[model samples]
Target: MPDFSPTELAVPGFVALVLIEMIWARRRNPRAYEPKDTLTSLAFGLGSTVSGLLFGGAFLALFLWAWQFRLFDVPWSWWAFALCFVLDDLAYYWVHRFGHRVRWFWASHVNHHSSQHYNLSTALRQTWTGFLTLGFAFKLPLVLIGFHPGMIAICAGFNLIYQFWIHTEAIGRMPRWFEAVMNTPSHHRVHHATNPRYLDRNYAGVFIVWDRMFGTFEAEVDNEKIRYGIVKQLGSFNLLWAVFHEWIGIVQDMWRAPWGSKLGYLLREPGWTHDGSRETSDMIRQRWQERQGEQTKSVSTENPIAGEAEPA
Candidate 1:
């Protein structure tokens, strides 16, 4: 039983880097480090760390138990570690996607997006209720495929470590080739953005390729300033509200919803409502796209390109 947790090793690095980013933010954009927001985000990090401590063991045991039925006896070789890393990332892509698409999962995940600031600290804004979401199941197939639970665990920690640096505004963009294959800061900013075009986009954990292959990739447009945080911003920095607001919303919605529609509140996408009062990410993006199209047509009518014919 190898007891190596890379994340545990990286805690000091995480803190040191955040402090570095704060100094950089002060010189670059002071607003990037709102004391309250950063504090809230750090608190989220602490709570999530505690929750992971309390819950991560059970999931590891479940993975080991599932390993007894592995179809192939995969060895602990360098190549095996590499393959497990790739496969686990693919699994993370789906877990992240569902964390947005399903309200139940979103209730746990929304807190990660609660911060309006995009800094290294934001990466620490993890879900305290992730165990409740049962999203760890997404990685079960890897165990069943013969990857050791420890191998997957180490790989996932590295996957998490890879994600931490990408959660910053300090580094604008990675080199072109690197950006093409890997998930860079520019690519991930789109993931954390609330801009309609960016909503629910770029769910990659380590590689941006999953998003490109799945047709969920959206490039960050330079002209459009991203509004970080959820569609309905948590205007208050109340730690409890930030952490558990969505879960509370779920309960309230389920209680008021008619019996038949009750489950919809739990299973449907976040922001979904029986009567369509609140807008889902899909609805908001559609409306934004239509408006952009209409604006393009209006501009074309007003400024016809030299010899282009006008509409009757």
Candidate 2:
């Protein structure tokens, strides 16, 4: 297996930061860290690590196999590292976008979004079944484009590490210049939010520029409340239920679906259905936008700014 394990080395730092954030949450907002929720999230992280241990060798083998066909022999250097980091992030952006857009992938990703509380622990709420989703295929291009699978693996580690600190309400916003280019707490919060307008947006892993460029960017509105978790909140903290609920859902839908449309259960957006019974993110956003428009129109029509009643 190609080896570079920045994530393994960062474990201590992660624990310390989680403790610091927990202290901060106690002082600032106790609601930010539910004991059960945090425990569930940590369990999710532990399970995800075990899953990676089991499947990582196979994934690495695939990447290394593809490396033989690389278009360029990108050498190990500072510039190569920089290029790999950026490209790996770009790959992450698409993988993340698909994780929401496609149902099969979302079954795994939804594990990360199951908790209602948002905090540093929330960042550790990873998916145990990510290997089953085949999301790592997104990085195949980087390997085939000449980045060493090991270097790409290192960059991916650093990318995950970078994302951890952003999953909090402890920071309102970053410096304007930093937020403009980097994925900050502000940007990632919108990604976690279940609000209609915020759904399926801000998919950047390291760089915020990808979402802005792809038109999936949505700024957090100070006046708008953000409710964390999936569209349908899983009320229980039962760890097994949290991990497998969506996977079970996908299987159930596919089994019951007609033969011709069964694949839609796997391929379509998370809420898509055969009988128009469910609402996709697009549908939810569209309804929200229309309601907002009507509200604006009604406000303007009913309370016209009376032309300052003929000046004195």
Cα error, candidate 2, residue 264 (Å)? 0.8
What candidate 1 gets wrong by more than 4 Å, as runs, is 306-312
Task: Give me the overall lDDT of model 1.
Answer: 0.93
The positional error of residue 200 in candidate 1, measured at the CA in angstroms, is 0.6
TM-score for all predictions? 0.97, 0.96
User: Which candidate comes out best when scored by TM-score?
Assistant: 1
Model 2 lDDT per residue over 169-215, tens place: 99999999999999999999999999999999999999999999999
Model 1 residue 37 lDDT?
Answer: 89
Which pairs of residues clash in candidate 1, taking residues 3 or more apart in a chain or in different chains?
Answer: none
Candidate 1 least-lDDT 10 residues: 301-310
